[model samples]
Target: MKIGLYFGTFNPIHVGHLTLANHIAEHSNLDQVWFVVTPQSPFKKKSSLLDNHQRLEMVYRATKDYDKLRPSDIEFGLNQPNYTIDTLTYLHEKFPNHEFALIMGEDNLKSFHKWKNYEIILENHYIYVYPRLTKVKTASQFKDHPKIFNISAPIMGLSSTFIRQEIKAGKNIRPMLPEHVWEYLDEMNFYK
Candidate 1:
């Protein structure tokens, strides 16, 4: 099976995430899109993230209804400050028969060259890039790369940061998250 790895911290899984992942899965050749929940992103501050298990649970709830979308805790067991290349390598070895590809935003592609062993990643696997609202331009090298595919998916303006801030401010963010995820957050009183 061809799996697109959508990596994120997912402090709280939201509808925007689900919509984008589902769009990619339905439109692309990939059979499944796994929401790889990162325990700690190298570029993000760990202190701002929710507990790994809690965030994973929210992802599970958000993706449970979608056949093509699934939640993954693969990165939780990996070393701290883990790089995408390392995760890709481990996943390849673990699931030898399944092909893995990357699911990223156009904004992320702008900084792709800085990622560890990015050249190796491009050589070994295909990348599915979705449109994102960003002022930065993508690197010229990636524009015509054979391994990179530009998917005309919807540009999601919603972000987890905005959701968290709203929740903390006592605003109803019910529309931003899945029904189950909203209930989980309310019951736990998270980000308040």
Candidate 2:
């Protein structure tokens, strides 16, 4: 199976994440899209960030109904401050038969060159780039690279930070999250 890894902290999984993952899974040749829940870096603690399992639970609730989407906590067991290269290598070894690709935003593509072992990553796996509201230009090398595919998914301006802020301000951000995820957050009193 071909799986596209969509990495995020997902402090609280929301609609924007679901929509983007679903769109890519349905529109692209990828067989499935994995919402790879990134674990918090041990070096930089943020008060607002939920525990890794809590965030993973939110992701599970958000994606439970989608056949093509699934939640992944692969990074939780890895070393802290893990890089993409490490995770990719680990997954490749674990699932040798499956072809893995990366799902990223246009904004990340702009700074792709700075990532550790970026050349090795490009040589081994494909990258699926979705549109983002960024003015920065992508690196010229990636503009027409064979390993990189530009997916014309809709640009979602919504963000987890904005949702958290709205919740903290006592605003009903129900529309911004999945029904189950909203209930989970409400029950846990997260970001409030």
Candidate 3:
């Protein structure tokens, strides 16, 4: 079985996230797209991050109905300052039978080399990159790259940070997140 690993903080799982995962699963060769919830992203700010488990739960709630989309808390047990290469190694060891692929936007592709053991990640796993408004120059930067895919899913250009900001401002996030997830966010008063 082939699985596309879509890693993110998912501060609050939204429609854009669901759409991308659905798009990848439907359009790609992979059988499923796992949402690998990151406890902390090295490149991102830690001050504004909510509890990792809560974020993971929202992801679970958002993707519960979709069998093709799964919420994976694999990074929760791993070391802090989680790196993609480390997670990939651990998953490969644990699930040897399943073929794992890396899923990300073109934005991440441009900054791929900064990651630890980046060379190993490129060599070991297939990378499926989705296009964003900012077309990153990944092809020129990384030679002999892994399986790069450009999916035609709808792009909302929305970020978890933006969603959180909207909540903090007492603005409605109904348009930002899925119906169920937004309901939970309202009930919990997250990002307040």
TM-score of each: 0.95, 0.98, 0.91
Candidate 1 lDDT score at position 126: 98
Q: lDDT values of the candidates? A: 0.93, 0.94, 0.84
lDDT of 3: 0.84
Displacement of residue 141 (Cα, Å) in model 3 is: 4.8
Tens-place lDDT per residue, model 3, 1-192, is 999999888887888889989998999899999999988756677777778888888998999999899999999999777778888889989999999999988888888888899877877788887878776676574645445656677776888888888889988779878777888888887889
Specify the poorest-scoring 10-residue window by lDDT in model 1: 40-49
TM-score of 2: 0.98
**Per-residue lDDT of 45 in model 1:** 62
Candidate 1 segments whose C-alpha is farther than 4 A from its true place: 41-46
Instruction: Give the clash count for model 3.
Output: 0
The C-alpha local distance difference test score for the whole of candidate 1 amounts to 0.93
**Candidate 2 lDDT over residue span 113-172, tens digit each:** 999999999999999999987656888999899999999898899999999999999999
Q: Which scores greater on TM-score, model 1 or model 3?
A: 1
Ranking by TM-score: 2, 1, 3
Which regions of candidate 2 deviate over 4 angstroms? Answer: none
